[model samples]
Target chain A: MSVSSQDIPTAAISRLVIYLRILEALEAAEISRTSSSDLAERAQVTAFQVRKDLAYFGRFGTRGMGYTVPLLKRELMRVLGLNRTWNVVIMGMGRLGQAVANYPGASDYQFGYVGLFDIDPELVGREIRGLKVQHADELKGFVQTRPVDLGFLAVPPEHAQAAAQTLVSAGIRGILNFAPTMIQPRLIPGSSEVESEWKAVSVENVDFLAGMKRLAFYTLNPHLRPSELKPSELSSTELEA
Target chain B: MSVSSQDIPTAAISRLVIYLRILEALEAAEISRTSSSDLAERAQVTAFQVRKDLAYFGRFGTRGMGYTVPLLKRELMRVLGLNRTWNVVIMGMGRLGQAVANYPGASDYQFGYVGLFDIDPELVGREIRGLKVQHADELKGFVQTRPVDLGFLAVPPEHAQAAAQTLVSAGIRGILNFAPTMIQPRLIPGSSEVESEWKAVSVENVDFLAGMKRLAFYTLNPHLRPSELKPSELSSTELEA
Candidate 1:
């Protein structure tokens, strides 16, 4: 609680997840203690960055022994707000939505799959991965009645904004938007005095197009990787930037 | 070729795509001659960062006038290797694979969907979005006879590494992996005296689990965003870091 969320960089928060993944793997491999340098190597980040990102949350790394795998992993879990189970729903039970619903990693991260939804009538009564596909129209009512901490927008690009609006009205605070379009945090107009206040939510997009665009850049410019560049000119320059 | 890809930061590459999108949207909306500060607000990055990221490619921002719309967009297109169309294939007919095959953003980014391949006998020869699904075994033969710049790996987690190896042996360079697993760079053993060598391929994974984790963090700690934070300390530190 000492460190406000605003105190940490969003990039650091993202890197923390990567660190958590790496630490989890190392812990599974029975590695007890590791240095920031080693962790930096696995994470493709600098030692100073690894240390600085961790330092904001308090000292997880000992001066000499580096970071204890289990201890650091626990700290990251709490920092990432993954210490508790998050009930989630997948809107738009399309192929992508189905894939997300059945994705195996969700359980590992404690994301509980509670509901499946779609706007199409044909998909409404269908069963996907043991959950019945509810109408997209029911989203607000369902969320108001049930506990859904997160929503996954796997709808088509054209339907994305509408789907996001539905989720917002449903009181979804967190959204993992797979739709190609970037969903901005907008004010939802209130109808009455009781609801005139505005609400803003968090949206994280898992855009493979951006990933592919990055791949295209790296593939076309393989020589650009920092490791292959001149040490003095490359290391501190971009890392600091 | 004037700027080595290494000289430009990878983070900048990611931002360039965002800038490209923002610029494209502006172009579509008939806006021209926007400043770095305005671009920064739309892209959610710092004005200095917008300039610094662009400076790596070439000077796009004018001393006071900011950037000309079409010129900057054209330069970014060239720098991102988006000037040419990339022939691509999706190597799975599964739910996620089908969705990727149907993803509309690829065309907007100059990625041409050339082929679809899957290992399932039933899926073979089936037309998905008008492209015939070829057997996975035919990948090497097809690539040898044709040109494929990228591949989308949407196979099950267990088959990801092997599928990636197959794509590599087929000489495909870029891959956007959708499996809920991390595919690392590994030694690929080639058969026979003429082919007894190992090669590496670039992979970008679109893991929603990571996105969801980030969402959970923000949902739990909403005060982190710059707009919500106290105006003082949240400005430059993380942006530079």
Candidate 2:
């Protein structure tokens, strides 16, 4: 059955991560259960919003007892597709790419680094963090051998699109692109003899520059408090921009 | 008096940047004006949402017509505090720090690299991207000499809090922390004091891991869809997560 109209919103996914982290912290502190109000306070949303976001996944939280810490955490992890280990690859062995590839927390969340690739001839075949840096040409071959779930693109803006195409052509889908350029996904129309494949890929862009601009705008406009951002949704007095 | 209730949302600021970039591209292509629908299409939001976001700043579009390209761009830049130059300091000269310090687009956006600092003696006194890296101890002295508008924290997670404290103690109000850990703001009291000065600061955390998590989540749960994200806002049918 198609679930197009019933899909969860991306904003809710982000809030899910926030809730997941908070729940994990509470669990670490030996807290058994938490109310929507507690999650709302840490997440800077509202108790109602928390309930609604969680409702999208399934029934959660008791009538008066709230949600069990470990149960909610497990449910979120399952909904987020974090129930299994995901093999990840990093493209472009530049400084940023290397830093992301070598991040210590990747394993803590079950995101395992399986491969590193770069187009530069010198970087090809080089070993970094115990993973070999394969040439870009071998991407498809590598993907065929290993089930790469995510391709973290850290290439320069000029080469970003091509690197993404490589990942896509190699059958990699989920992309975390840090190239500061937009990449739209669409199926390529083929000739009468060729079949056009559906371009189904999920791209999450981490725009560092935009984040910096937000901080600048908010800090410069101190009179603009965090609680008054929109007409809808619960007000938040968060310290973030 | 109080503009807290009338403050623009941080999300609006982000969309403003998106509009600015799109407008710039259109201007370069000789396009003069655009309808809110056009901006919304490119920005992955509804035309009504576009009008609402822009309305938070000021009136822009003409009656029964679209907004003038250059004028809206200038207005957005001004609203985002991009009209003036922003002095930025990069702390922790690791790979990430070096990459950010030497970023090519900083000058284009009027964000200038004024100072670089790290706790390591080896990194201290090093010149990167023409800006000298000072010891973390020299942060307060450098802030006194330079009017740094943004403190970009790229230090390790363990040292993130101390690095933030240095920036705050140096009177830097705007901070963009890339540290994966949480950095809370508060006053530090000395041994013989009842209370220390309240450290009021604006912090924007750029958690890269969360971005990656979203990418993985959407890729696996393609049925969830990107447009289905926010309950309070317009439903987007665009293909992004």
Candidate 3:
């Protein structure tokens, strides 16, 4: 039941979550077991890669029998560290932050929106989706007593770094930054900076830019068919160009 | 300068856009040429990986000279299809949609928010951030004349699928879906269906979930140590678990 650092790849871990989601759907449809190929097809990956990825953790499938839906789901939940609930704090109660707080998916993932924080005095003490908006000054005190392991940064780009610094100083470890700005902060003295990791989950902006690039590429070369473009070739060419 | 479908991995291309943003910041700081090592450091990636990724696009770097600041920036812009403006429409301009509309990063990426749409009569004829909210019935007409390639969906889960179908039917080729729901729609008869092509980019609630998972893993197993967690191992473990 104990997982070491060598246990899994981050990418594979993401896919496992996706696979679990697919399995949940299948289970709801009353399907009992599924082969790697079936899972890969539904999850938009290759069967060989799926098998290889699964093998890295431990064998979860038989040669021909595939995997039991319920057992695999339980195992995935355990491996993903999802068996326990995660306390989440939304650092900004702006429209984006409020949207995130009200996001139904948060409940599905068991991410309890423990508190909401913002600096605007007019907005302070207000309630958003039932979560009271607390002042930013209370972050450290709140973290000391309640102890949040994860924080979401939905503040504007200018405030992102400061917000992250506050969270780090407040003893929060993992941050899902949505500010669409780069945040670089020096680790506090005596803190475990080595183990700390920050993920910049740029939202619709990245996707918008990506979609624009694809459209631009397509528009410029109208004669080229979409089928002619290969993902591998794109990777190689982009690197070599 | 033509890029065929075989030229890049979609994931890598997405990362390239991210790198472009970082490079822009470096350029703004008046940094001239940047070596792969420097770029990697700034982007939180490896030097060799940066070189490898850039090499796939083309030999933009000199053997030891690194990449020229302005020239590389221009090239990245061209590669990411950011050379031209992209008109965007947001459906369901509720809290999430409004957040996206006012997101400063969207404007930086040249995504002009052309309009917002909702079925609610109260919202119709109102303007949020200068983009007038229109009836959902106007979507098809607006798309036909204005010809928007991208659309953002911020509708509730129950309405997501129908909205997506409407957008696809209206000939909007690219979609940025923010609805936290699963959407599976059968291709309309006589409509194009490209297997490798993804016209709709589903931004699931995965980012938050991923951050939570990482935090859980890091916190619950503090003794596991960072060196033990190889990217590949994490991938495999997540898959099998």
Candidate 4:
């Protein structure tokens, strides 16, 4: 079966990433084959839910047997566009930005930090994790010379919008915003709101504060955890779990 | 309307967080009343979705009138358990932990950093944002002296489980795990598999790598974006949008 991006639910895509992690763990343990039930238990969802999620892309497992772990892992990786390395640039080299730049997981996932930018005069010209921090004004010139696939917005909330605009103007494909504020696609100078080019720029937000709020809710209501719910209940409320 | 934790969908809870953020923006702009359409536009979801999500909590709006911004925001804060301050401690005082400890947003939401812990001797006794880093072994003693509602797990993947166990043993109510690894509640000593006490410890995972992967997929297939989808199409697949 052929697959289009719209054919899959956004939650399924997030779960695919989780499924890929499970497959990686299984591979490390030298496990070759797995069933939907195995994945469901580890993913904290139902077996049928796992099958339905994978079915959106294509078929994989046998009726009585199971799925080939490595094969499914490869397919999921390919679907998520993780098979290749992504060159990244960090905007606003604050503590969070510098920490992400030095993070070991970035290299593990092939997310290379090619350039770093900061507006602070003291931070500019300083070297961090081998790459020299350049002034934010130098972003456009730096991007023209080097292809940056993803731009990380780690600036304060007040500066997030301008930083995002700079990334979009610099022709960056995607943004992983770490700011607490929401970044919207404002109308370009000569373009109508409907035809704005900024719409083409993909943005994904990462908020530890939001995660903490979820934790707070769960802490207040531990009896209602998605992972610990019954299988029948799992199917009914598994959205974004 | 009576509301149980199980009555609400996990995705709805997440949307409530988003809605709360939007309400905060409205209040900041001095807006008093706002309609579902107004919230829907900013949140990038259908107005019907906003109505349905709020319905899970209780009645808030009238037939023709909109919601009171501050009132709705206060209700959401209560539902999300964010009304009171949560005393938090940071585990694994590496760069990520230090950044989180020093992040200004922490104070904005009342996530006070009470204590900092690390395995490294060099880091121990060092100060970050007015809190001195303590050795990991002192967590039990520290918790006994003061209340620690949340624990931020910023350790590497290899050490995540041990650190998580330490947090659980210290009676931390919740954990915001920043490690890339999956932290499971293994069976505690003398407890049956199903009766493990660790299950009571709430854990929320924050993976910037997973967010980056989502960015990759969206970059590859911007045409299938959830926010840009038609209203008719949105209701069908807004499972986790």
Candidate 5:
């Protein structure tokens, strides 16, 4: 059964991943069965939302018993396409690229950082943790020959778009861009209209800038404190409504 | 006017920073006025949510006319504490730490990476991108003298808790920890609850792990295709109900 792209909401997909993580943790702790409420509590979401999300995917729960931890974990792992290893290429062997390459989380997720690309002559020949750095000029050929599934962009903000375009041109489907730039790339001519598929480019700027702004806000408005800036339970309820 | 801790939600505080970024972009583009709807569209949120969020801080918007971009921007900047420069220290001068130390986002947000600390003797004497790598043993003295408001923990998961504890003990308040491990440190006895407040540690593991799980799920469950994942729009009837 070949799965197409429209069966699940991206938000639901993201949540499924979280559920898998919680299930993994539970499995590690020698736990088996888990109710929707328990999973929701662990995942920091509501049980109704969890059930609805899972229902959207497929019925995998029992009425009274709820969900079997191991079974649901397997189902989620299957749904998320994590059963196979994903080969990742890191563009720009800069500080951020190197950090991603060395991140244990990436390793834990089974993302194999097979190669590193850079324009720096000094870094091109260097090896970082056994992964040899290659020249950025080789990116096109490397992608064609190696068929990398995902590309991580850690280049400077100015070079981010060019790097993304290069990756897209090289037939890379998924991208995890780290550069702080807005990438509004136009789709190739004759491609079917897909409602602007925004790739998961996790920008780390939010936390840093947010923290700075929070501090600044508190400084100027001496009466308006940090605790007061957080979303209240009532606000979240209203937003959901 | 001293602001108490109970006013805003932490999530909203984070969004205020995001709003500030958007405002800065608008200001750069020379756009003067923006409606809550416009802001919501750009920021990928609901207009009502934006209005509600801004209302918590103060009334910066006028009915029928919308918000003054420049004025709202200035207010947000002042509210987020971005007016003052924040000195930051990166603990665990490994690849992750070095990456964060050289992060352009931090520099753009006025977070000065004053120092990098590590236990490794080899790294302690080194300098990366002008920031001196200091001995971790000197963290206490450095924090006492320099009075850093924020600390970035990029150390291995095992060392994250200790590094955070050290920073907290040194009177640092905000922490942006990158280590994948969960740090649940015990609060010191007799310390004021407000001053010795729980550090707002945002986990960066969700993306990598969640993405992996999502990919894995789609891979195994060939029946569940990506195109089927679109969220169903809430109908007027549903809203009425």
Candidate 6:
């Protein structure tokens, strides 16, 4: 069955990501099949919720038998666009940027770090994770020669907007911004217009403080916890985004 | 009116954090009051959503005058348990942990980093951001003398559980786990029992890879973007958690 993207809730996509991770874990454990109930138990959602989430994509399970873990994992990888390699450029090679460049998880999902950019002359010539830190001036030219799908913004708050503008101008398709502040792309030429080339650049924020605040609230109101969190369900907040 | 936390959706609490930030910005600009529509514009949410989320707490807006910025900000801070100081300790002194310790935003919300701990003999005696790194073994004793409300778990995945256990034994009430792997608190003695002392420790996961995966999906399916993201609306994924 054909499915329109709009018909899918963003939460389902987030859940799908979690389900995919569960399937991978199951696969590594030498398990070949999993039932909706098993997936729900592992995901910390109700069985019906798991079925509904998977149903959005199409039927994958047998009525009597559960799903084959490998088959489901592949389907999810394709659905989340993880089956292919995604080239990324990291902006601002500070401590956070350097840490992100070295984060082992990215390469596991095939997110290859193609370029690293910084304004500091001291950092410009440095090689990090085998990629040389290029000056910000080279970003526009670098993208012309190399295909970079996403930019990781880890600069200080004040420079986040300008740095994002640079990434947008460089024709990056998306950004995973770690900067604590918001970056408005309005500074980029034609960003406000529907016909603008840079208008569709999507940004996903990684705010460590937001999680800290939520932990504070949950600590103060444990009884208000949406559920008794299982390890798999502990990251429910991740799905909310 | 008295409100129960169970009635509040975690997504609404996340939004409240963002709204609080917006109110702070408004107060900084010397803007005294804001309409729901205006707050909605800044928050990239519908005006009705702003009203409904705020309604969960109590009526804060006047018919035409809207909400007083400073008053709303204080109310949100109270609702979020951010009005008081929260003593925190960094559990791992790795690169990611150091970056988080130096991050200036935590102090703005009254999250005070009172201690830093690591097992590395090389790092244990070093001082970072004026907080000396102590041996992991010192954690239980440290907390008895100085109260710590939260533990920032930045250890590698393999050691995340053990490090978290150390924090739990030290009586940390919550955890902001930055580890790439999930830490199941089941390892803690009596954690599975309702009457257990360690059963109440809350954990908030900060998975940088999760955000990258969402960005990949959004980049490939821009038409599926939940909404046209303005600067304030850009981090909708943050609220989804």
TM-score of each: 0.88, 0.86, 0.79, 0.87, 0.77, 0.86
Candidate 6 chain A, run of 10 with poorest lDDT: A232-241
lDDT of 6 at B171: 80
Report the C-alpha displacement of residue B44, candidate 6, in angstroms: 6.2
Off by over 4 Å in 5: A1-10, A186-241, B1-11, B184-241
Score candidate 3 by lDDT: 0.64
Query: Higher lDDT: candidate 3 or 4?
Result: 4
Q: List the residue pairs that clash in candidate 1.
A: A224-B6
User: In candidate 4, what are the lDDT values of residues B62-125, reduced to their tens digit?
Assistant: 7677788899899888888888899999998888887788665768778888999999989999
Name the weakest run of 10 consecutive residues (lDDT summed) in model 1 chain A: A232-241
What is candidate 6's CA lDDT for residue B109? 88
True contacts kept of each: 0.65, 0.54, 0.23, 0.65, 0.44, 0.61
RMSD of each: 5.7, 6.1, 8.2, 5.3, 7.4, 5.1
Question: What is the full ranking by lDDT, best candidate first?
Answer: 6, 4, 1, 2, 3, 5
Candidate 2 ranges beyond 4 A from true positions: A1-5, A28-31, A186-198, A227-241, B1-7, B28-30, B186-199, B227-241
TM-score of 5: 0.77
**What local lDDT score does residue A125 receive in model 5, on the 0 to 100 scale?**
84
Candidate 1 lDDT, B1-241, residue by residue in tens? 4576456666788899889877776676566667787678667778889888887877766576667778778888888888888999889888778878877788887898888999998899998888899999999888988889998998988898788878877888778888888765522233533123222356677877789888988888877854522213112222211
Tens digits of per-residue lDDT for model 2, A1-241? 1224585667788899989987876687677778888788667677888988888877777777777889989888887777788898899998778777765566777988899999898888889889889888888998988689998998887788778878878888788987777554521233422112123578888777777778778788755636421212222222211
Candidate 6 docking band: medium
Report the error of model 4 at residue B7, Å.
5.3
Q: How many residue pairs clash in each candidate at the backbone level?
A: 1, 3, 40, 0, 54, 6
Per-residue C-alpha lDDT of model 1 across residues A99-204, encoded as one tens digit per residue: 7787767898789888989988989999988889999888888887889999999999888877887887778878889988876553222254312222357888
Q: DockQ values for all predictions?
A: 0.45, 0.40, 0.25, 0.49, 0.31, 0.49
